[model samples]
Target: MTAHSRNTPQFYLTAPSPCPYLKGQFERKVFTHLVGDDAAQLNDLLTHGGFRRSQTIAYRPACETCRACVSVRVRVDAFEWTKAFRRNRALNADLVGLDRDATPNSEQYSLFRAYLDSRHSDGGMADMTVLDYATMVEDSHVRTRLVEYRRRGPDTAVNGRGAGPLYAVALVDHLSDGLSLVYSFYEPEHRDRGLGTHVILDHVQRARALGLPYLYLGYWVEGSAKMDYKRRFRPQEHLGPAGWELKDG
Candidate 1:
């Protein structure tokens, strides 16, 4: 029998759109729905095959004339922090991350808006309202969580979590094999602290503690400066024609 006959996913291709990662290129995506009781399992399988989830949709690049985008996942067990990464971690020591259920809140919206205004002011999500932010966080059917980062408060030692002003937030998806970093945003003024890199490092540590083998970093498009930092997570695997292969420095 065919995979679809076994209730496996049916894929569909999206219409061409202006590429968000690179200028002067059109992009298309082949996607499948994540729904029903099997959504979690299906999402895991698809993600392993180099797909990324957005709400209930699992998609990957299917551009006709370009192949710049490549899916990347760090091998958690073998990952080692470089000197720069260590410095970034140390610089953000005052920040604490807390993982909570995938629910929307005004605080998250406020930070998200500031992040967009600072970093992605001319990007597509610049005009997103609170309701749009809420949908981005809570519309998913698969297992998801919101990781909040804030300044460490005096009471953190007793509470074991931050209780100060929010600084960053990441929308994460839990898969059987690994954790997918769906999206993340942080305070723009704190750019010098490398809060973005710190968050990914924290997730890598969290995955190791959870016994998960990989931390999916999503697509890394070649020639895109915005995605260049992803390569810093050494001993990472990139999805290619032969499946996941380790990329050498």
Candidate 2:
């Protein structure tokens, strides 16, 4: 049972694996493939329904006992530009994000490898090879873009592109209603610059500029300090039993 008729996607459940966020617990996922002519439409629908995409697969946690993986999205127009956020943005003012087609390259992989080795050494993606990273970037069926963060060059104003080595990268999906932050990585050595927060902040302004209402930020796992950063970008709407509910800053 791979797919159903009339473009109805077939759903499958993954076997339980050790939970990454919570110790002594397991994690399972219900997922479907995003393919065919309706891939983008299906992705839009699934993401709104609390699913997140990896390559061409759309999945959400199916852990029966735990419901901590909460889908979160930032309201672009209602976003709070707090003093801390302002300072963080100012800190990375010299860096610029250049949006390009979702094509994987060696340079991006090098940065990604270094980031994983430094910060997420024991995480799931720590063992991913260059080929895996390339597939992750290029295997998408829906509209996706890679925003490479680099230092601003002398001719940045003329060409509208960044300069120098890559410091951070964000894999984003352009949905019908919003831009989804699929995955992001940064140079772990520059921890003081808050590159992760900077990427999200840049996307918030990008969403506003594009007249998009939301910036889908995948999930926010409760009690996971690693997931706590998602909380700073407010005001955000958390998807729940009643759908997305707004939370104040």
Computed on alpha carbons, the lDDT of every model, listed in order, comes to: 0.91, 0.93
- Clashing residue pair totals per candidate (backbone < 3 A): 0, 0
Q: What root-mean-square deviation over C-alphas does model 2 reach?
A: 1.5
Look at candidate 2 and give me any clashing residue pairs.
none
- Tell me the tens digit of each residue's lDDT in model 2 across 58-136: 9999997899999999999988999999999999999999999999999999999999999999999999999999999
Q: Candidate 2: minimum summed lDDT over ten consecutive residues — where?
A: 1-10
For model 1, the stretches where C-alpha displacement exceeds 4 angstroms are 1-8
Model 2 compared with the native: what TM-score?
A: 0.97
lDDT of 1 at 80: 83
